[model samples]
Structure formats: structure tokens, C-alpha cells
Target chain A: MHFPISDVTINPIYLICLGFFVGILGGFFGVGGSFLAGPALFAFGVPMNFVVGTDLIHIVGKSIVAARKHWTLGNIDLRLALIMVAGTIAGIQVGVSGIEALKKINRVDWVVGLIAIVVYTSISFFVAWEGWRTSKLPALKSKGKTEDQSAVSKDKMAFRKFTRWIQRIPLHPRVSLPHSGIKSISVWAILGVSFIGGAFSSFLGGGAGYIRMPCMVYLLGIPTHIAVGTDLFEIVVSASVGSFQHALHGNVDILIALIMQTGAAIGAQIGATLTQYFTGPRIRLAFAPLPLLGAGLIIYGLITGHHTR
Target chain B: MSRSRDIKSFLIDLAVYGVLVVAYFILVLQFFGGWLTDLFHNHRLGYAIVAIMLMVTQAAGLEVIAHFVLKLVRPKKP
Candidate 1:
């Protein structure tokens, strides 16, 4: 399909299939799946600016259902999510402004692509190491349940101790998230984490869950389930804010996003359902290379100007 | 056996959803493509509004329809 809005000719089928693939991954990992979506679009010859903004619009759609489901499951921390939205919106605005500034200099593509390569590579290696480290722990294996919060207290994520330090920071006007098992945490801590997540969201697209979800759990000490649910919820708001801002700048291609989302809507259900059958750490280990795959494609695209034939 | 049954039902759900998605996108998005592109270039805010509304409707609306239709077919599921 020729998407005149973005001035690209792509097979709608390819977009749909990509959405399905990423949808399953998102559903499986309980995330917005932009880690793949943005890079994949860029590799498919979409510009970086469009990839960033278009993916956010798509995420807003996907997360609506997932977030609603989590809300019903009592997995959401509404207070935390709402507060994070405030910080997230601010960060998203700043991030989009950065993209706009880059757009003026005609350096958006290579610079953003380089940043994505570094970030994706780092994430790939870190997840690989963490998944390997976590899987070898016999105590967690014996628990026979994924995301056992108590067991995760001693989990060897290398940054598990940082959560304690973050939670201990003495800031005023603290709030408790009883749902996520957080007690008396500074609001600033929550905002600081969310602000970073939002910046990532606007810069790279999707919900930025790949960064935020882990932060919510490890940095804030929220239970895994609650973090997933709450972060997904916040993705909707942040992505919407991102979409509107990006749309104003003509960085979004709605035609492409809508076509892609049709496939994601169903694939997300399948992905979420399939998760019941998989062991947790193994899934994480397998997922370790996906970001690398995306980064590889972006590299190929950068070198040759397009990975597609 | 029940697990297999569940997977089978899920596959059926996907097939049905696939058909629905193909039909809907071809009918709606394809028809409005040029017009949306015009709005995108000439009136961006309108394009953005339509884009967001279209996304939300497809997401919230179609999912409900999918589930409702699936329930009617598989009345025993509740």
C-alpha cells in the first residue's frame, strides 16, 4: 500500500503481520512492544520521526484493552498511574520537542537511529545477563511461580538493591501504594521514574514499557503484576499525549497506524493467552535477543538506507 | 484434553477476528485514505482528531464486538 501521508509504499500485509508479531510479544511480555515496533518500522523504510510518533498512536489503541483488562484484574495502581501521567506528559512534550528540533536540522534519522542502536543493544545484553542470573537461582525456581515478589527481594537483577535505595530517599509528601505493596514512597521518586519513561516513549515510540515496567518493579518495589498493569495503563495516557503532539508536527501517519493496529488487537489476545503455558525466566531469556534483532535491522537500514528490497 | 480444546477455540477466535479485520480495514481505511491524507496535509489538527477517534473506536468498539459475537457462538463459555 502506498501511504501518501508518509510518502512510503509498504505492503499493508507486512504492517499487519508485523503488528501481529509484536502484539504477541507485547502480550507475552505484558508491554506495549515499541522496542520492536519503532525499529521495525524504521527498518521497513519508514522515517524515524514517523516511526516514533506513529508507534505511539498505535500503542494508545493497544493499551486501552490491555489496561482495561488489568484494571478488572485488580492489577492496576490507579493512584500511582495517575500521578505518573502528570510527569509522563511533561517528559513526552520535551521529548517531542527534541524530535522537532532534530527535524529542523535534517539530522533526525541517523541520530535517532544511532541512539536506538545503543539503547537496544544495551537492553539486549542486560536482559540476557539478568535472565541468566535469575534463572540459575534455585530459591526462585523452587517457588514455582513467576513474579513471586518476596522471592524477587533477593533476586539477582544487579539493580535489586537500587530499589531499596530509591525507596529510602527522604522526600516529603510521600504516598503509599497498598495495591502494589509499596509503603510510604516519595512522590518525587515515582515522578522521576515516569519522567524518564515518558521521554523514552516519545523518542522511541510505543509505551516505553521495556524501560518503565522494570523501573516500576525494581526502582519502586512494586509487585511485578501491579507494575505491569499500572505501566500499561500509563502508556495509554502518555501515548495519547505523544500522538497529539506528534500529530501537530505532522510526524504521525494515521493510515499506517490504523492498518497495523487491526492486526495487533487480535494478536495481543493470543499473546496474552499463550503466556499461561510458558515458564517466566525462559521467556525472558528468549526475549533477550529480540531487541538486538530490531537493532540489527536498524543498523542494516542505516548502512544501506533501507533493509527492504 | 481441555487445554487442547481451549487452544482450538482460541484459534477459531483468531480466524474469525482475521476475517473481521480484513473486511473492516478494506472497507473503512481504504475508502478514506485520500481524504485523510488531505486532512493530514491541509488541516493537521483535524487529522489528529480523526486519527485518535478512529483508533479508539476500532480498539474499544471492535474488541467488544469480537467478544460479544464469540460469546454468542460459544454460549457455554461464561
Candidate 2:
């Protein structure tokens, strides 16, 4: 019997092993493991579309696990989740269409590549900045850590000023969430971020968290754990929708998705469990290298014209 | 006393499952392509078929493991 290979289909065993390792990394770092998933699938001769589509599907399982774990830990801010999801879904849609439009003019790949680099660097810098601040000013750092979990900070004028600005916007009939202190946020902002998240999920198949999680934490004043949970929860929607859209275009490979998702699911469990061992910043720091490496690889792929095996 | 509430909760649960199922099928079809086209266009649907099998098996298998872990840690209500 002859085995079929794509431009770069490594052994199935390799894919499974990679999934396991990436799963651990994701769990340890609080990411969806798409950073690893995309490249692994690519190595297996999966087309860019399938790599992305399946990667999104793969993320769903892990996010479910992570979100549940966070919820149980009382780290989930339900209201903030809803708001970020709203933004992420909307942002992703616009991003997807924007990609499509760019494709017509034939520069989609480069545009996306550039955006990914920028997003990657920005997230890296944010994480690094936090580390820098902590090292420089222990007093200032300790206050921001989740360890200082007091009721919403009244003294943090910056937080209050930003949050007040959010409140002043006319967002009536704001959706309140269960067990969360956040009352509401602008639907427009939610839609905007969601659309961008959607586009990222659609195009790259797994970068939504990089965008949505941060937006929730910084712009929306959501706690880091909640942002992580909600971001994962929201990916289920974004990925599913994007996957369905891709399937309509006939790009999904259920069998491949199944295999990788299997390894990924087990990995997710381990990953979610691992979250208990590390603080948000520590986890972020630990996993920081993966995205930086991934970005470099993608740039190499682009320059080499080697998207596939 | 709470039949109405139970019904509403059930309905919501149903909606969530419905959405998940629909989303799953849609995703499967998108990345793998429709069965007919995949068969015709490439004449090599075998890889895709195997891939789907791998993903589904992994997901279901892990869920079982998770259930076991959950049960071991906190037994389900009888």
C-alpha cells in the first residue's frame, strides 16, 4: 500500500506527538496552541486553508477545557466575556471580509503576514513590559497582580478613568452577566473586536486569543484570568463559524481535524491543569518564545514561497 | 413548583448543543471539502478521511478521560 503525502505530510505519529507537546505548552502558557498547531499541520502537507480550519477546530476543545477550569476557579468574569465576545465576533468578520477584498487585489498573504508580525510583537512587548515594570517597581507591580484581589479598585484612578469613559458611552440595555461585576460595555466595541478576532481565526486559524484576550484585559478592564477564559470561550464561536464558512467553500478535512483534535483534547486537559502552577505573567513569559519563533517561521515561509511541504 | 424553569433551562441546553453540532458539521465539511468534490478533485480523499478519523477519535477519547477524571474527583449525583 502506498502512503499519500502532501507538500509536507510528516508521519501521523509525529503529528500526534507534536500535538501532545504543544498541548502541554499551551496549558503551561495559557494559549490555545495554535501557534504550534498551524505549523505542525502545515508540515503534514495540509493546505493553508485546512491547517487553519482544523487548527480552529482544534482550539475549540482546549478552550472549552480551559474556560471550565477557570470558571471553577472563580476566575471568569462572565459580563466581560460577553462584551469581548461581542467585540471579537464583529472584529473577525470585518477582518475576514477585509482579507477577501485584499485577495481580489492579490496581496492578502503579505498583508496578513505583516499584521501577524505586528500583533505578535505587540503581545510579546506587552508581556515583556509587565515583566520590566515588576522588576523595576515592586510596589507598583504587587498592586496590579491578581494577588491583590480586592473589590474593584476605587483607588486605581487610571482604571476608574478608563472604565468611566467606557460607561459614559450610550450603551443602553447593556447585557449583564451572571456572577460578574461588570455591568456592560459598548456593543460597537465588542462587535469591532469580534470581527477582528473572526478575521484572524479565519485567515490564520488561531490568533484570535492574541488579540481578543488582550483587548479584554487592557481596553475593557477585564481581569486576566477572565480575559483568558472568555477569549477561549469566544474562539469556539469564531472558529466554528469560520470553519463552517470554510467547509461551505469545501476546505475542511474532518478526519484530519479528528486526529489532531484527539491529541489536542488530551493535551488541553493537561494544559488546563497546569495553569494552577503558574501565575498569569509567569505563564505569559514562559510561552512568549513560541509565538516569536512562530512569527519567524512564517516569515521564512513567506520569503521562501514555501507555504506547504 | 419549578417545571417552567426546568423547561427553559432544558431548552437553552438544547440550543447550545444544537449550535455545537451544526458548527461541528460545518467545520468538518469546510476544511475537508464536500465528500463528492474531495473524491473527484483530488482522487485522494484517503488522507482527509484518515485525518477526520484521527481528530474525532481524539476528541471523543479525551472527553471520556475527562469524564473519568471528573468522576474520580467528584462523583456525579445519583
Candidate 3:
């Protein structure tokens, strides 16, 4: 299809297929799918600005599809998600303004890319190691272990001591999220974590779910399934804000987003349904490689200065 | 009989989404072609508001459609 806004003549089939593949991953992981889609769009000759903007547009739509499916399965923690939004919005403003300042200094490209590569690589390896360790535990072999409950319990013990220590801080106005099974967590703690996620999202120009999902499970002690659903819910709101901002800046190609979303909607449904068949640890294990892939892509971009925009 | 009903429901759901998507596209094009340009020229904030409203409407509408389809196609438990 010839998308005039980006002035790119690409096959619609390829875009649809890309959307389908990313949609499945996004639905399963609660991400914006930009780590995969952004590079592919750049490779297809779309400008970097348009790639980010258009990806946000598709992400908003795709997230809605995925989140709805997850909601049907009772996976979303609406209370937590709503609370996080306040911090996320504030963080996004800070990140965006910081980037604008960096741009004025003419160091936004390589500096940002290098930091992204380092951060993505470190986090990816850590998540992968944790997933690998969990997968090897004897608890994984427990009989008829639906939802990997035994494995999850064992994993909880490892992080439980740390969480307990953090929970002891005399922070006021602690909130309890029953859906996520979190008994009590200070509102400040939730906002602090959400702010960092939102900052990474705006700075890296990606959905930030890669960071937030793991944090929800590991730090906030939310279950993996609920984290995925809540992440998607967060993505829907953040991506909507991002797409609108990008559109105002004349960066989005609405036609491309519209076409890609058609495939993404279908693929998201399939991916969300497929999650019902997998255990929580198994899902985490599968997610471990995606960030590594993103890290590798950023490194490649840094080295080649290809698609640096 | 159940299988046929499920298929019929799926088709109807698909048709509904298709209609909504088409309507959404028309609305976007109409707004962009008419008032949106002027709004943008007058105030960037106005453009941002409209753009957000449009995007949110599209996303919400698509989510509703997707939820309906998923409900229709949910696997039957034995």
C-alpha cells in the first residue's frame, strides 16, 4: 500500500503480517509491540518519527483488543492500573521534556540509543536468568499444578522477604488491590514504580511494558497474568496519549495504523486466548527472550547508526 | 445446531466490526478534511484535543467490537 503521509510504498500484506506477529507478542506480554514493529517500519523506509507515531496508534487499538480478552479471563487489576495512570502521566511529561532538552543539545540520538541498549540488555539478562532459574525448580514438577501455583508460591518466598521489608516503611495511605492479590502497598510505592516505567516509555519511545510487567511481578508481587492484563490496560491509555501528541506534531500516518490494526486485532485475540493454556512461569519464560531481542536490535542500530532516527 | 448458531453469530459480529471500522475511517477523513485543519491552524491544543478524542473513540469502539467477538467465539466447556 502507498501510504502518502510517510511517502512509503510498501506491500500491505507485509504490514499485516508484521502486525499479526507483533500483535501476538503484545497480547501475551502486555507491550506496545514497537520493539519489533519500529525496526521493521524503519527497514521499510518509514521515517523514524512516523514509525514511533504510527506504532503508538496501532498499539492503542491492539492493546484494547488484548486487554478486553484478558479482562474476560479475569486477569486485569483495574484499581491498580487506574492508580498507576496518575504517576505515568506525570513521568511521561518529565521524560518528554527531558528528551526535548537533550535534542536541543544535539546529543539525543547516540546517547539515547546507547542508554537504551545498556538498560534493555541488563534487564533482559536478569529476567532471562530468573525465568531459567524458576523453570528448573523442583516445584515446577508438582502434580496437576494448575496455573503453576506451586512454582509461583516457591518463587514468592524468594522475593517475599524483600517485599515485606519494603512494605514495612511507614508510608501513609496504603492501598490494597484484591484482584492482584496484593494485600497492602503504599500509594507512593506504586506511583514511584509507575513513574519510572512511564519515563522509560517516553525516553525510549517504546511501550515500556517490558519494564513494567516484570516490575509488577517481581517488585509489586503481582501475579504474571494479572501483570500482563494490567500492562495492556496501561498501554491503551499511554499509547492513546502518545498517538495524539504525535498526530499533533504531524508524525502519524493514520492509514498505516488503520490497516495494521485490522490484523493486530485478530492476532491479539488469538494470543490472549492462548495464554489460558500456559502456566505463569511458562509465560514468563517465553517473555524472557523478547527483551534480549530488543536489546540486540538497539545495539545493532547503535553500531551501524542505521535507523538511528 | 449449536455449531451453526455459533458460526452465524461470529459472522454477525464480524460484520458489525467491519461497519464500525468503515464508519470510523469516514469520520476521521471528514474531520481532517474540514474542521481539524482549521482547528490546528487556530490552536495546537484544539488539534490535540480532537486528535485524542478521535483516537480514543476508535480504540474504545474497536475494543467493544473485539470483546463482543471474543464472547461469541469463547470455547464451550464440556
Tell me, by TM-score, which candidate is best.
1
Residues B1-78 of candidate 2: C-alpha lDDT, one tens digit per residue = 365554454444334433443455446546644553445246444544444343434455445554554444442233
After superposition, candidate 1 runs with Cα above 4 Å error: A139-151, A156-161, A306-309, B1-4, B75-78
Question: On residues A1-309, what C-alpha lDDT tens digit does candidate 3 reach at each position?
Answer: 565556677897787677777877765765566766765665566655556567667677666756777889988899999888888877777766665566556555556656766776776677677677666766456566644566567767888887776655569889989998778888887888789887877666667786787677777888888888888888778767766666666656666676666656556655665665565665777777776676566555545553323
**TM-score, prediction 2:** 0.70
Q: Return the lDDT, model 3, position A249.
A: 61
- The positional error of residue A105 in candidate 1, measured at the CA in angstroms, is 0.5
Order the candidate numbers by TM-score, best to worst: 1, 3, 2
Q: Rank the candidates by DockQ, best first.
A: 1, 3, 2
Tell me how far the alpha carbon of residue A169 in candidate 1 is from the true structure, in angstroms, after superposition.
3.0
Candidate 2 per-residue lDDT, tens place, A121-198, comes to 666676666544434444544676452232123234447676557645676655544454556666665555566667
Q: Give the B-chain TM-score of model 1.
A: 0.83
Clashes of 2: 49
Superposed by TM-score, candidate 2 places the C-alpha of residue A172 at a distance from the truth, in angstroms, of 4.3
